[model samples]
Target: MPTPWRPFASYNLWLQFAPPIGQERWHCDMKRGFTKARSREPLVATLLATDTTPQRIGLLAQRGVYEFHQDPLMLYRSDAVTKVAEILQLNQESAVVQERVISILKNYYSNPILFGKNIIKLSRGDEGFPEPILIEQGNYQFNLFAAIDCIFKEQDGTLHILDFKTGQTDFDRRQAYVYLLAASFLYPTQPAVASFYNLENQKWSDPITATASHLNAFQIEMARISQQHQKDLQRYRHSPSEFKRIFPPNPGINCQYCPFNSICSFSELEVSA
Candidate 1:
């Protein structure tokens, strides 16, 4: 008996690299949009797998800064460009606080001691950072990309992946699972540990062990979501106007904080009205 040909095997090969000539010609018609769509899938998968400590801390800080605009009680501290310009013109005392915040951010990047072990030195002398690995299992392909904040290797060969968080928030279990999934793919039999160091609170959470079952489930979900997103992109290509109509208007809330709000008619009306 002859071996059967699998359609998915060919499809997976095409997906890993470039499309075939016929598919490429079809893609060329939607090249610009398709490029963005293709880039977004892997980016999302990377985020899922390795958006570890530094990213979480940065995201929390950004959210806190953006919250100043959305909350009325915090509006006086809004750091929006227009408000900053007005404060500068008035020679406000708050400018000093702004400068201090900027200084803190600068020092955070420049001073290694302040961050302590939380800062994973990716570059060692002339040696480069470890390259991210892209792995395919079943229907899903995701990148295992993590810049370890700190790695503790046991004499027995147990590997601990320590992540540092600058925010006061607790460790996100979902994120830890994603890291575990990536680690398992890389080191199938090795024990993996995940930890979070919250700088704001000056605390380190207990390390969490990731099980194989959890990782398998997450991988399945990722594949399904990626496929759905691809389908959504195809539908959007068929009717862009229909896709635009699906989402609701932002109203006025997003205007004051949005960087590009000045050029938007809805924003202009909301701000000036």
Candidate 2:
């Protein structure tokens, strides 16, 4: 029989392992534990099942873009935004979700950045999980998962990987790095660059390119994180009661926004007071 599935690494797992620069105070390892370790627990499962407002809007906005490109004439139609809204069933969503998603649809319709491009891949954002890239360095091996949003070839033949954003979240350069690393493996001979575009505000990030050394460094970090996360899972299995010690919590004003806040005793004790 094939060996057991290898550990996995992704930009999301990297975020959970450590906070982005200037945002360390809001980092909570326990949230990672709740998400990756205790995800099967009923309460945690329920919370994970529900999409937060930001998540819902992002998904709908991405779907809206996909809908527009799905039909060549949809973009030119006078009721383009309304048709995408109907396709997205925005009427069923909450008022806030409806309003923001509609705005995003309008923004994309007005701009239509990807309107005419040498497109490679485009995701609707609801596709569960992407296929994993098996990576092996020496005896250390793990799966690297990169869910790229869109990929198109530039006029110069360089592969351009674009990630879409919604809301006020700043573009994390690390995410762009991960995309470039993934591209290096997926299209070894092709030069590639990554960037971010905010659909809500129409902000576009500068194209981010990485050197061979930078890609190697990212791979090393990804491998380390994969092994460490596997060790964490094993530790949790051995002593479930020591979960707090295994994954410490830093409860603060941000706890109100944590999905696990309702069940996290630390957040309940610290933030509620």
Candidate 3:
């Protein structure tokens, strides 16, 4: 089997060839850890994931977020509704938190602008996609995976790819474009547009159309990055014991969020306020 490299949906720092042997070692070591045991979710992450379960409104609702507003009650008494509570470690405020979460969903999904699309595919996390899209350039092959929030069609048959964002983190357009890149090939017959919608800020980004010219440019860039990653990967594979000198650690604020922060030698940043 060909080793599958992660698709470049987000321009993650670790995905690129980080300078110095230390940072590269850190990146490779973290990936090695991922192949071993799946780490348990930290309490902080569990708390955040539980609180944000309503982001699934896009997948569960008939008309994405709009239908969620119309029938939020329908989602009550469901696994989707209770999974968060179950992960909360039986806190005394579980009931209150559940109610508040429901209210937050109601407020966000109530926007009328979210309606009027004929949506067929809905996904959250890794649930909505099928086999990965293979992006091959010469000897480089990247398996592109996109778990799009919602895939809907307008009256005129234009497909819209939606990505739901709950937090205020700054992001680039690469995410939507990657989604579009995979989707364009997934539904080859249809024209697709991808955009991001922030639930907390209630801000919708301008749609980025997926066209031959646009995707061609993106393909060249992706192929280039994949080739670089391929080279980096070869170094580690050829001299596994020499990874210390090949890939180095570059740690800062981001290390605080990494699961391996405790294990990494350079992890020093604080994650909280």
Candidate 4:
């Protein structure tokens, strides 16, 4: 059986490990999706789509009591917000979601102390760093698929790779490390640090530093695991008996959210008594 190719470096791919690999394929192929009357896409897209900086400086006077200059286009951002609402399929839009997104943006933007230059020219935007940096090596191709939310410099000139989250974060460090790894490659000469900002939880993770040797090892591991998954998938597809031998229905933590739970014998779905 010819194995389909998938780059191993992605954080998403590792989340699914079906004893083997073909079980996930079977689950996806057999599962169904339904439409809902109200979708949250509008709120999410609106939050994602607008640039909050312009609004903060131009409209909200978020600089507190300090004499501050506003962005010329602050009022114009509301149009951008509404446009995003249209893109997300919310005809009327939700006031609550809009307020939440704006609040997060204002909070993040106002904290110039945390985001601003303290003692050094570390704010890379202030430090003159490039946007949308790209890095590709071996079978791992990373070209803005997973974006670094923000990249800047610390007072000590440590390059920082930041990821911002709007929801509760319960351990997604692997993704943060991947961002750090990419940043390391992008800035070969500079020391790089990685961290996560959970906006909803109002928490910032302790920044981590990455070594080239460690990043290279992770790259090797990703390639190995990805190729192994493909190989396991081939083995599982050989025959139903062999498939069962390799990819047995053994469900545990992943079962509750598994799309294939309905068809999976080991998922422990309750019988109609």
Clashes of each: 0, 0, 11, 3
- Residue 264 CA error for candidate 2 (Å)? 0.8
How would you encode candidate 3's per-residue C-alpha lDDT over 102-215 as one tens digit per residue? 444554545534555576665534343456677765665676666676788878888888877655554457776777877777888888888877665678888888668888
Candidate 1 lDDT at 92 equals 43
- Steric clash pairs (candidate 1): none
Q: Which one is best on TM-score? A: 2
lDDT of 2 by residue, 1-273 (tens): 964787999999999999889899889999999999999999999999999999999899888988999998998899999999999999999999998998999999999999899889999889988888888867998988999989999999999999999999899999999899888889999999999999999999999999999999999999999999999999999999989999999888779789888788888546455
Off by over 4 Å in 1: 1-132, 140-148, 154-156, 245-273
TM-score of each: 0.48, 0.97, 0.64, 0.52
The lDDT of model 3 is 0.55
Q: Which window of 10 residues has the lowest lDDT sum in candidate 4? A: 29-38
Report the C-alpha lDDT of model 1 over 1-273, residue by residue, as the tens digit. Answer: 953322121122223233333433222212223233333556444533443434433543333333322334433333443343342332342454444434333333333222222322222111223444565667555444444444555556676665556644456555566567667867678887877755344466787875677777766654554454455567776776544332223435434533324333344446545
- The candidate 2 region of ten consecutive residues with least summed lDDT is 264-273
List runs of model 2 lying over 4 Å from the truth: 1-4, 268-273
- What value of lDDT does candidate 1 attain over all alpha carbons? 0.45
Angstrom error at residue 144, model 1: 5.2
For 1-273, candidate 4 gives per-residue lDDT tens digits of 953433333444443342233344334211111001111346433443453433322222222201111233433354543433343333333565456554554454444334333322122111222343344556454332344546667777788776555644354666766666666667778887787766444678888766778887766655565565556555545643454445455445545544445445566445321
Between prediction 2 and prediction 3, the one with superior TM-score is 2
